[model samples]
Target: MIVDPAARRADGESVRIAKDVLCAGATVRLCLPDGPEEWAKALAKRGERRPVVVGDDRALLRVVSLLHRERDLAGSVLSMVPVGGAVSLARSLGVPTGAVAAARAVLDGAERRMDLLVDDSDGVVLGGLTIPPLRDGRGAARPASPPAHPWLSTCRSLVRGFTARPARAAAPDDAAPTRLRVEADGVTLADLDHPVAGVSVGPAARTGYARVEVHPALTAPGTAPPPSPLHADARTVTVTGADFRYRADAVVTGPVRRRTWAVRAGAWGLALPPRP
Candidate 1:
């Protein structure tokens, strides 16, 4: 079993539970590495043992990345005993949240194939990806010296409420709509001529594709944005045209002007609780 340093530091109880459970049922080997180099060495040394990760999303990502680089991801079945503050990736992949339950699953579960989103850079996103808007977009679009002030803001809210469109996802204070050209399966979804509020991409269950959603920038107050934030599913998604950053699962990556992620059907195997 590999225990992430953060997990050991943040939630010792969960780590203890996982260790105890695994030790009771199997011949468990404990690996406590201090840094990335040591962690890689530990994983590299696991010759034939089915590695069980005891940590959160980042920890899992690290393991998958290592295996993928080694070209062994398709053949390896991974067991995870998530023990940290953010286990959203694990939960999304059908892993139990409770330490005891997840530990038990590690020993009792069956190996299941899982889809993955892999970028051109070999980065993996187990949960989802989000590209928040650039903050300056709103300022650029703001009408200068409007006398209505608060009234305009109120009217925009009212119109949005009555329109029955999906509520706009909140972004960070600094986020602003950016001009990006987005494409999926060779089809253009958004062009650089228009700024976009945000973009989200994630694996679509059993569909062999990833769901892509892009929110358009609202230029004028009390008016609905044109094209109503496109949504689609595709085997490949590409974003280009401007230097942009995105959050993949819990980790943020890039400021690169272009990136493409392709769905790898059953790219990795995850040990999940066996069905009844």
Candidate 2:
């Protein structure tokens, strides 16, 4: 098992629980790295033994990113025992949220294929990606936060309050709504002429496709209402606009003028709990 240092720092007890369960349930090699370099080195040398990441979504993404860089992602079967405050992506991917349950799933689960979105710069998104990347809905209105371990949730809140990036203040001359042109497959869903509140792209319900959605900017009082929001399932999604930011797999990135993402169906394998 490759244990992330951040996971150990955030919730050592949960890490201990996952480790104990994994050790007792199967023949495993524990890799307790002192830092990021060592942690990556451990994974690099993790030959033959199933690589079970004991950490949050970030660590899982790190693992996937590293493996993808090495061109070893497709042939490897991966498992994760969610152990930190930010394991929402792991939970969404069907890994058990509890330490014991997740570790147990790692031991007894079967591998399942999952879709991936690969971007122009070779970045990967295992979960949804948002244009503005707002976590709290950017207003008084917002969605409830995902559930997480009580203590881990507290820990994450404390850490985030200190380390999270400050929200970007809007600049003068900037458009009230983001102005971008979005395309799915070859059809245009949005364009620079029409401002958009936001855009998001990710795996769709249908296999071998991605769901691309463009949210229209709220109607101005005197202007005709913007076209209704557009959405479609496509093999590829492209966006071109002024510098913009995006959040993928819970990490914020980019101020790029253009970005394109293509769906790679069944690109990797993840372990899920055994069927009932």
Candidate 3:
């Protein structure tokens, strides 16, 4: 078990419950260490022990990143208690929100080998995408930031819900549509310069599985193109353009001229509760 100290103060009861559960099971080891690096190092030395993360989504991402970097994901079983904020990924994976329930699920759960998305530099177990219409100081298209906590994101949603505003109407001659060339499995789907809103790629995307999504710059009125099909289960994808930036799993990494992505199936095992 790995626990983030920062999260303990905010979620003491959940942490205590998780600790009791683990204590009852003598086989489990608790790793409430100083920081991520130490925890990762400890995990690296532990070989294939079943890991139960006690933080939120960022904590999960940290573990996934470490596993991917160390090439130790093949046999690892990852479980989570969702003790902190920002647990969207956990919720999406069907893990219960409460600590006792999550711990129980961890103890009585199944092992699932899931697909992961590998890019040139990093591997994302959840999803990735490239969004147009850059915000802040970032130029052109850039990836959005991953939420810090699940509750913070919920607050954002609530705020948006209460102060929603109408979108501005589009007009002609705003800006010429930029050309985008997309190819998947030796097939060309888009090769025209038009007002691009967003592009998404994923596996079983409509069902809310792992996927890649792209949001292009807003179009002007009638210039918006119809929704295009994406190769959700594509094994490889190559994207290139000068006017766009790239983001992976909500982290903007590059504004390069070209980028490639490959999917690795059954790359990692996760400890998760059975879907209800």
Candidate 4:
């Protein structure tokens, strides 16, 4: 078990509960790393042990991204216990949000193969990837995953209850509609001639492909964005624009001029609670 330092600080109780549950069920080697260097060292020495991460969505993404870079992610069969407030990413990927339940799943769950997207820059996106993210009333990106609790609706955090913010001030234009050329499976869905309000791309469940949607900019103030935005299913999706930033796996990335992401069917394995 790898306990993220942030998780230890965020909720010691949940970390303890997860440790106890996991230890009771099976032999465990616990590594408490205070920094990324130590964290990387621990994972490198893990040998044959399947890693169970006890932390929030960021922790999970760290593990996956590291293993992916090392080219071992496909076989790592990772598991996660969402122990912090910003865990919607893990929950959306089917991990239990409760520490106890998630730890139990780590021990008893089945290894399930999951699809993933690989960007041209070699970055990975596990959850949905959004270019010009979906905006809320305040014009900030909505939580990457729908909150499981009703009270979360009012929290305006970028990743839904995730309170961290980029250092940049006055970011209203970041969420505004922008020009981007979108293509899926070689078909152009949106072009630079017309700006798009948002572009969402993610793996379609059980389809071994990506589902792409491009919402056009609103035609009038207070008027709904045009209905029936362009949509497609494809093995690959590409976006090109002057400069844009996007969020994937609940983390923000890039203002790159172009990015191409290809879906790799069953690229990695995750341990998930057995379906009822």
Candidate 5:
């Protein structure tokens, strides 16, 4: 089991529960790596043992990334027990939210293939990516706040009030939306002249394509909303415009002028609890 330091810091109870459950099921080797480099080494030495990540989305991504770089991703089956400050990615992939349940799943689950998005820079996206709605000339509006934890909702709210990024002041004039050229499978989704409010790309229901959506900024009261957020499913999604930032799963990245992510069908595998 590979335990992330951030997971320990964010929710030790969940981490403990996962460990206890996993240990009870089978012989286990606990890997407590302090940082990414150590984490890579731990995974490298995993040998035949199935690598089970005991942390949040970022932790899981790290393992996937390292394995991909080693050319071992397609053949490796991974298990995960989500325990962290952010678990949306894990939850979205159908992993149980409860520590005991997740750990139990890890022990008895079946391996299932999942699709992935590999970008130009070789980074992967297991969940999804989004370009937040532009707010005037100022930087993009902070991505929507993560949903509060159900049981610890109140605590999260209190914590966020103290930690939230200060809101940017409104610009002196009505700033134009960011002008971006978005394409899916080489088909134009959004033209550059008209600024767009947001764009999202994710694994689609179909096996080998990504669902892309481009939402144009709301126009004046009378004008039609720029052709209802363009939507499509494609094997590749590309965005080109001025330097912009985007959120991929839990991490925010990019100021790049262009990025293209291609769908890699069944590029990765996950060990998930059997249905029914």
Candidate 6:
């Protein structure tokens, strides 16, 4: 299945590569941009089968969300060809960068079942939460806000640097740090009030991956904070009483507290290229 937003397909090459793969005997299906809900409905009626996404990280997240919702993740396979902007998450997963290489991976690579995160509100199978400094009046503070045009998003991030706010007393850095109590497998790892530069959780993290991190406000920085509480096989993580926001894959999903997420092990298979 190729769940693509029409905006992404505006590029001529992507469409041509997709058609080339299909013509070469790949069983391809297009999931248009009506909404994920409609795609889910179509998927449900299609019955059990492996799924391959042909868009960026967000598209991959959408398929995972659907599988988790149906509780069919353990038996299904998922793959991707990463054909849009914001493909960093997929790159982290070792998926090839070029369209042809990615397509070949989908067609010939070995299948592997990976862990997925299931939250009460939404489920994501890739990178989650990296809180950068909130953008000023430009509206980059919230994740749910639709991403500005790619150039605009970049320009806005740059402009935020000049208009940065003063630090606050509690954070001592005027950064809007959230007070969060994070627990995993019934053990408390982080319990404090401090400015948080960013937080990321996912299997894609390697020796350098940080399960959790807190830093002084960006405006008050001396040195970057070190990675903290790395989880090699983190199955369950909970975040509570934090006013901070989080980005999952490429979308900003929440500002809610009391969020609990668990990883479903060996949940879905993904396509990859054959070894040379």
Better of 4 and 6 by TM-score: 4
Model 5, span 1-276: residue lDDT tens? 999999899999899989999899998999999988999899889999999999889899999999998889998999999987688889989899899999998998998899999999999999899987554645555676665667577787789899999876676644556888999999998988777888999989999999999988755656775677788999999999888889998688978899999999999999888978
Q: What tens-digit string does per-residue lDDT give for candidate 6 at 1-276?
A: 655765256455875685577448666666565686787875675565456677777777777777777877667767787787778988877788787787777777788666566677765645555544333343235556767578888888788887877644344233344456666656765565544444456554533222544343333447655445334335677766645566766677666767777776666667766647
Q: What's the distance in Å from true for residue 190, model 1? A: 0.7
lDDT of candidate 4 over 98-140, digit per residue (tens): 8888998999999998888999999988888888743334544
Off by over 4 Å in 2: 133-175, 222-226
Write one digit per residue (lDDT tens) for candidate 3, span 1-276: 888776697788889998898778647777777876797776876756788889887777788889888887786888889977777677876778888888887888898777777767675746546545333232245677989888999999899989989655444323333456655544554554643455566565433233544434445555555565444345766666665665555566656766666777777777777767
TM-score for each predicted model, relative to the true structure? 0.84, 0.82, 0.73, 0.82, 0.84, 0.69
lDDT of 3 at 58: 73
Worst 10 residues of 2 by lDDT: 133-142
Clashing pairs in 6: 78-269, 109-272, 167-173, 167-174, 168-174
Regions of candidate 4 where Cα sits further than 4 Å from its true position: 133-175, 219-227
Superpose all Cα atoms of candidate 1 onto the true structure and report the RMSD in Å to 1 decimal: 8.5
TM-score winner between 1 and 2, please give it: 1
| C-alpha RMSD between model 3 and the true structure | 12.5
How many clashes would you count in candidate 1?
6
Q: Candidate 6's C-alpha lDDT?
A: 0.63
Pick the lDDT winner: 5
Q: Relative to the unseen true structure, what is the C-alpha lDDT of residue 57 in candidate 3, on a scale of 0 to 100?
A: 78
lDDT, model 6, position 159: 85
